[model samples]
Target chain A: MSHDLDWIAADWGSTRLRLWAMAADGTRLAERSSQPERAPRTPAEFETILRALAGDWLERTGTIVACGMLGAREGWVEVPYRPVPCAVTPAALTRAPVAAADTRPTLSLHVVSGLSQATPPDVMRGEETQIAGFLAKNDGWDGVICLPGTHTKWAHVSAGEVVSFQTFMTGELFALLSEQSVLRHGVAEAGWDADAFADALSDTISRPEKLAGKLFALRGGHLLDDLDPATARARLSGLLIGAELAAAKPYWLGQNMALIGSDTVAHPYAEGLAAQGVTVLRADADDMTLAGLRAAHAQLAGA
Target chain B: MSHDLDWIAADWGSTRLRLWAMAADGTRLAERSSQPERAPRTPAEFETILRALAGDWLERTGTIVACGMLGAREGWVEVPYRPVPCAVTPAALTRAPVAAADTRPTLSLHVVSGLSQATPPDVMRGEETQIAGFLAKNDGWDGVICLPGTHTKWAHVSAGEVVSFQTFMTGELFALLSEQSVLRHGVAEAGWDADAFADALSDTISRPEKLAGKLFALRGGHLLDDLDPATARARLSGLLIGAELAAAKPYWLGQNMALIGSDTVAHPYAEGLAAQGVTVLRADADDMTLAGLRAAHAQLAGA
Candidate 1:
């Protein structure tokens, strides 16, 4: 709880909450944490938890500027989304003026708004703002910036703002298909075969048209005669990833792409896109999000 | 029961069993049925059920020519698979003699051999002989024939034998994806939109690469937002069918494809293929299998 702090920021999602205290120079002075918004805690309970984690600093600092799911309607505090085609600056964030429970109502707080894409209404919760933060840091970047996670975001970025993006339920589908479907019989317990995965990716992308039918080739090639479950499992994985690549190709057209995420999440795709004649720059995820958050906080403080 | 009958023919699968009494001229004189070979009936119990269904005819006919899963290792009787790249014919299906009952050795029987495709080693039980019978009835006809059921088979036919084929695990995947996946969220409890299905087929075939990505769009369009479940379910259904169409395309290139199965099974695909600019001819399942069986029986009889 440093009195000299200029701002506080948080990135909230379905499973985790991260809070940061910053100096005017945007150096993180301290950190706080809590379970995700879905945690079995009421807004008051979560607020107490957040205060317990960083409340002392907040009392001393007298203000905080937070972003992410923590600011959503269902969050510890409700913040409505700012509509699309807006920049991801602190100014772009949707906010709520609130008086904290203190001897004197001293803390002022604001939350960022999620972004949406279409009439079909593809929207992001906390990550949209985080992405906007990333754009804020890397000015003049133009191309696709993929934020891969459970729900992978493939976005087109230009002139320091997210222009357009699509979401692929890749990790979730992989979990469901591999662990739940009858195809579960073919998956390996722990072992991974890079060759098999590459083969599958190639098989899927090369004949994207035949991707689904080829899935059965796993069972067909394994049971009732062909018994190659590993290949089959690999092939299924490939089909999904290949399908993602195909859907993502349009956004990456004629631009340099930066992949910002864990290598485990982004490497295969980088490998896949490389094969497709696309140059991809790989960056560390924590660095990107934190930098973006700092940039957003600094931009807001400056404003 | 016809005293003049020479033998009885049987078809067995995972869930159903069918039998018929035929004269030398292939005139079907009587009908009988029972639970499929997968049922818990012992050899004696199978005989009892068969006799109960057509015992009198068997007594008069004195012989049986049984096929399908009835001959698999796990069935009432084990009939080994005949390797592929060979004519699927009655003579090819001829097996070692088996007594209808240990106590009644006079009742003799022969079982049919199933067919197998190497490389990936896909095998078909019972249906290969039926297909052989079909080829015998319409000798020299070459094209694609679909045997649709819970698992639909699309086989490429040439020179009175199956040249190559691929199976669409469509039916099973549909059941698994709809009933089991998180997709169960917006799916209709039990209704399908034909218009939605038609659109799915078109989109699937047209943008085969987008198949996997579109599935996520189901939950993404609905959960993180609002969506029509029926249309969403239809979209899921279309995504799958589209994938199947993409996989099945290579086999149908520049060929006249005929769907040989029950009307209920073939019609949707017939409509789907029509939309894809492919003309399809339909054939009756019973007649085709009977024609196939009779051809096999006649071939073995001549030998």
Candidate 2:
């Protein structure tokens, strides 16, 4: 069973840890994850999780390349951020230090470095690996790539390098507003209205200053006018994304664009960008993440 | 102790219940509150809290004019909101019903109705009372009364009537971002940087759409540039408030403006307005509440 495995590819974010057992030809032989609910914390936890998922294959594995918050200060090891206006492929993968008394003492564990932008002072972890996967496939393709999540990032790509980028806390704001703020009482727990989203997106895009005022109106609309929960939910998403689009006009206005992810968060950006007359290419986030990890694994052989 | 008391003034909000023993001549004989940390919930709790604060005065009171979310649908009693384009004095104060078997079943309790704007879909619970107080003192003051708080309101007063209004979730957003969002890591629990705030305020106000991006930069700045926590805290506040000011430009651009509250929230609005060349008159929030209650009390005597 371990003969088919060559290296392990992992994407460890704050809320989840995914592991892929890979062959030398970059084919995934097996896949496992600690899902979003029960991700690892300390180095010991990471080791424990890894063994539980791929104990049979790891001892026979030649190398392991992990990406995302696994390299954060609070993670297994602190990997330095590679400042951008640089290549998507990590310049170096630091060997993640483990305890000396570890059972798999000779484990060749390495973590990818995240990217940093100086002027806007933005940083991205897991997304960089996804971007690397994207660049590896597209070669010299140049434009912008948008990866949407809690902390959504918009990167300017040129000549195979992440030239510059910006980030928006849009997803996080939407969650907090819908679940924690006074508006929570008015917005329904589950539902979505595309029309409401389009209207709200157009409203905020035209007048982004009205963002705060519009947020309260959602509650008022629900209480006084009996706004549908679905409408309120979609409008909340629309408003935040609209504000983001308006701000990111410089990045996506007339630029060729690709939106990563097929989830709810990415759907709106697709709709929002399409409304603005942009023909956006959509990519599956999971595939890109795996491809990114595979690209790193293949690079080690050439080096 | 109850001899001088004629009416009882109360301002019951989501987080606090304040009580003021009043004389027929509109004087506040004594004042007390439940404070922000622990407000009342059910009708029984409200009564218990009232007795704890002013047990003696309540027995001799002729009128108990209470204001704020105490009248909310979730409150003890749902005192209907007085739709705007109406006089500052509530159209009516619905008597809050006490349980038949209660200790003071005949208690003359009344909760002031908040104001509602139809077109914009806005509502003000406690700020309406503060506005009434301001109107009572200023006579025919006609302009915008900017009340700063979790849900800050800007009311348009014309000949004592609340012509129309808008609400900004500015303070609430600032709190959410500074204390709960990723930016919380960069911002200190307490501190202010006026210069940093001023710059961010100007930045967002000029380009309101740049808000979501600027927010992420606060965290990024702290990480990359060793940005001061105070600066991050102030910047978070400034960006939110700046977006609000931009939205409220039509209300305060060349109109007579008065800002209610003397605390952290109000200070920034005053400075932001002042920087825009508006000499904003400042007023204490508590003083206005009592005055507003007195105005309501005085009106009761006339009726």
Candidate 3:
């Protein structure tokens, strides 16, 4: 009997690691996740864990191609990054040789390279695949695409490759501001104030420099007098979004741009932008990441 | 030897209740503070707490003049608030009869009426007296005076009355933004970034509307890229201060203003405003509040 299994795909990042057992035709047979094996996990430990989780499948399968953190410098094995200006192809996800015990079954391992920014020196681990996935699915669309998360990505994608991008800590800031800041006391219930947000966006576009001081006004508006806490919180949202709009302006200008992410992340921008009469394209986050992972695995199976 | 203690000065507000035993000469002899007995405490309970703290002193001294929350409607004796266009004189304070109590202990408790803003529904607690003290000490100056605290106040003082003022929750915002927000991660350490703060302030002033979105950029700047947390924190500060400056533009009018408070609160604004060439007058907060309290008490004592 022939096993329909082929290459495996793993999306290992700093915090999450997901692996899929794919067939030669990109059919996912089984999937599993474990703590990312960065520096602490020994080869034996990884082998044991992988075997226990997908050992039966690995035994039946021949090669595994893992993208994301697994291919990082600090991954289980040192697979040199394909570096920027490289395509998200099988050639770029080239494998690094691993020394395993004689009892170990033969499996090919490949890692993907992360991207970095110059100047202030910013980088991302697993998001590149998501971007690639987004591009792969949308084929030949050029403009700015925002992937909002803890470390948000504002990418300029054209010609099927991410040309350049910037990361903003929007999600992290929201978490901190809502949960930790005194502004929490004044935040209103979750609801969008298109007018407030638009006002803030216009503020950013007009007075890019005012980004800093405007933050305190959130508290000032609510505290100096009786202010609706929900409005205050919304104002905070407006402020952060406004700042992102300002920082992302350089890349956002004169280009067709679409915001891709969850509703939680994209809706606010959509609301704010819609008020400004800017058309924004919405894309599903999970689908793009999964699709990208699937595409990477397909290329490896073909190789 | 008999002590001719002339007046009583009190600093009453939401959380704290402070009463000072001052001589006719305005020499403070002893001071007492407790949780403000606003509404929760009955007249008996309120008077008991007050008498227990200062009953003996009042007996030893002649008539005692008092100020602060003790004269509010919620006080042990309700003091009717003299509406706007009324002076902060001893007559205005004494015009309203104290609520009927047991034996009047020859102590005259005068309450200062809170100031209300017509344009925006807002009011000030005992800070008006503090503003009065600042004005009295400066010998009738016409300019802006900022009292920074839980609810920071920027008062336009001229002709002995607070002409018009706006309060900004600068202190509250600082507390909330620093502790509750994801910005907390980057702002764990407290250090001032003059440039970052100035930039934020400029950002706010330039784009007053961006007030809502500026804060999210903190996390974006810090997490997505390598931004100095210190600078990020300063940026937050700058955003708030900048917003305040924008709000205070009407009051400032490019005129020289005095900052009435300690360096702890005024220093940041002073530094931020210096760049804009706004001249600041620094005065002692304690001395000014005490002076105003004394003045109010003296008026009530004679009445």
Ranking by lDDT: 2, 1, 3
Candidate 1 at residue A94, lDDT?
Answer: 44
The TM-score values for the models, in the order shown, are: 0.71, 0.95, 0.68
User: TM-score ranking from best to worst?
Assistant: 2, 1, 3
lDDT winner among the candidates? 2
Per-residue lDDT tens digits for candidate 1, residues B1-303, read 334688778776666778888888889877766764446455665655555666667566656676776665556676666555666644366564445445452555666777666655466776675577667777677887777666677777777767776667676666666676656765765656778778877887878777656765665566556667777766676777766776777766677787777876666677778877889767778777777778777876887
Q: Which sections of candidate 1 miss by over 4 Å?
A: A1-83, A91-113, A119-121, A136-140, A223-232, A284-303, B3-81, B91-113, B126-140, B220-227, B261-265, B284-303
Q: Which portions of model 2 show Cα errors greater than 4 Å?
A: A1-3, A35-41, A52-62, B1-3, B35-41, B56-63
DockQ of each model vs. true complex: 0.35, 0.80, 0.13
> For residues B155-263, what per-residue lDDT tens digits would candidate 2 score against the true structure?
8888889899998888788788888887887899998899999999999889898998999998789878989999888888889888998999999999999999857
- Candidate numbers, best DockQ first, in rank order: 2, 1, 3
What does the lDDT read for residue B254 in candidate 3? Answer: 83
Distance (Å) between predicted and true CA of B296, model 3?
3.4
Query: What is the lDDT, from 0 to 100, of the residue B33 in candidate 3?
Result: 78
Best model per TM-score: 2
Q: A42-81 in candidate 1: lDDT tens per residue? A: 6665565556667667665755666566665556666655
CA error at residue A279 for candidate 1, angstroms: 3.4
